[model samples]
Target: MTEEKRIPMATIGFTTEDAREAARDSFYLDELDRQAEIASNSIFHAIMRGRETKNPHDPRVWGALQNTLFATICIARLLKPGPVREYPGLTKQQSQKYADERGEKLRKMLDVEDDCHILDVKAVRDAYEHYDEFFDRHLRDVS
Candidate 1:
């Protein structure tokens, strides 16, 4: 006669101790990091392109996309099982305060978590790679 072996549900253990937890946490952490980097670099590049274009209106064109990225990253940060849950959405300020605040929050995440960064390096490179050639070489002119 053969008896069936019952496996416990919700078991966090794998072949290695804490390996599952580490892998899960690492996945979320990577995602949070990726989202943050994309948000950070998107606007940073937009701002830089604005400067290169020498136009005050350049960034305005990217406002919506920037806002979306920030919101998405903020959500990812909140979901990462840490102190980032209360992240406030970008404020609707008339001045540059909104931009400044976004930049500050995005960069500051690196200090909170060791494996995190101001922006995802790959996302930044991918975002800007051939940016000029593919983006009409104008980056939606500010002026």
Candidate 2:
């Protein structure tokens, strides 16, 4: 008779150490690093193109700039994982709060400072999500 292997399910709300440990060892970390680098470069190139265009009203320039910022935020989110979202044990609100706290630390670690142009990356993301009309303003006038 052939032996069958059984994968153990979570007994309670806690994630299995094996799963977390596997994630730590996974190539996903390396991939995330690579993706971050690519997104950074993309932002730089987009800004360069915008400058070269020398036209404030150029849609291509504005589109690239906006897309890059959104891409950067997405990459940042991928780099920050939440235990509740990945595993279990917390309410949705609690999970979101925990993720937000971690995201704040990540922003600081990345030296993401708010200024006249960009008050907050997360806020920008939220605005983009909650208000489509926000984009109607001239991109050049964004600042």
Candidate 3:
């Protein structure tokens, strides 16, 4: 055998805080990617299942679609501009204000001229997430 090939290695240095911050950012980015994958997979499943059943109303199709919507909402939340490393303690109103500001900035940064309607599906996502509450409210109204 010829002489063994040598591999090069480099040392990167960072403060402890920088390392922690990088880890947090990595986690957030990974989560965003995971949610995106989930949304993509769920939509694909929904389409395939819907075609196979020839029924848009099929429960399995609906389930997959719901998953897609939920995952999309999670992605939207993850994209909300904010500190990735730490949760800043803020009152509900203040937090909402901050989010709104950040959201506008994010939209501008992404060059999004029009609102993404899919992000508005948070209400639908909530309905699916809290189905029991939805059912109870409807049952009460019916009674």
How do all models score by TM-score? 0.36, 0.47, 0.56
Candidate 2 C-alpha error for residue 37, in Å: 2.2
**Separate clash counts for every candidate:** 4, 0, 0
Q: Rank the candidates by lDDT, best first.
A: 3, 2, 1
Q: Predicted candidate 1: what Cα RMSD to the true structure?
A: 15.5
Clashing pairs in 2: none
lDDT of 1 at 22: 61
Q: Taking the tens digit of each residue's C-alpha lDDT, what string does model 2 give over 1-143?
A: 99999984432233888766455434344444666676677778777887788778887766766676676565556445334363278778787777777556554655654341333356667676766565565464666
lDDT of 3 by residue, 26-120 (tens): 66556667888999999999988888997657999998888989788776775553333333787666777766665565456555444577556
Best by lDDT: 3
Best by TM-score: 3
On a 0 to 100 scale, what is the lDDT of residue 91 in model 2?
Answer: 79
Residues 36-134, model 1: lDDT tens digits: 566666767766666676556665536635654564545433433222222365334422454444344544544444355423333554464556776
Write down the lDDT that model 2 would get: 0.60
Tell me how far the alpha carbon of residue 75 in candidate 3 is from the true structure, in angstroms, after superposition. 1.2
- Alpha-carbon deviation at 41 in model 1, angstroms: 1.7
